[model samples]
Target: MTEYATGLVYPNGIAADEVNKVLFVADFTGLHILDLVTGKQSWLSDGGGTYLNGIDGLYYYKGTLIGIQDSGNQGDRVVRFYCLLFNVDR
Candidate 1:
């Protein structure tokens, strides 16, 4: 498969957090959060696993991110992580 963000991970799996306004990219390098509003990138996990080959899929449930990690050794696996949204009243 073709992969972008060469230095990072995943290169495939991607997710969207509507409420938080962030897009989660599971690109093998790690879990990345792209700010939907500003189009900024942030890392969640530097290296989720040894082989962060790809991100099969991603979804949001109860304000958390549930996704799949595709690797070389293990075909595919499901993983869960938390996403926090900070609210500031100006």
Candidate 2:
């Protein structure tokens, strides 16, 4: 298979949104989004002031992004992100 992405520190999990043609990748660095059609990579920031880090599992459910995080100081928890809130529909 061909490498679709690079420059990730520690890739852990991924989820795809077929309807939006986008791919969500979670790594040790942060959360990232890849456009399937345009091949554009972008960083996803939490506007709610939640700093995402050390994400290990990713899931896309009903237009929402669910992230399983295993951080050192933050501990283990789940985070939900509304896909439509981000400017990824381009």
- Alpha-carbon lDDT, every model: 0.59, 0.81
In model 2, which runs have C-alpha deviations exceeding 4 angstroms? 86-90
Q: Please write out the lDDT profile of model 2 over residues 1-90, one tens digit for every residue.
A: 745678887899899985767888998888988887778788887666886778899999988889898857278899888877544555
Q: State the lDDT at 14 in candidate 1.
A: 67
Worst 10 residues of 2 by lDDT: 81-90
lDDT of 2: 0.81
Tell me the spans in candidate 1 whose CA falls farther than 4 Å from its real position. 1-10, 46-53, 73-75, 85-90
Best by TM-score: 2
Question: Model 1 misses residue 80 by how many Å?
Answer: 0.8
Q: Give TM per candidate.
A: 0.61, 0.84
Q: How many clashes in each structure?
A: 10, 0
Worst 10 residues of 1 by lDDT: 81-90
Quote the lDDT for 81 in model 1: 65
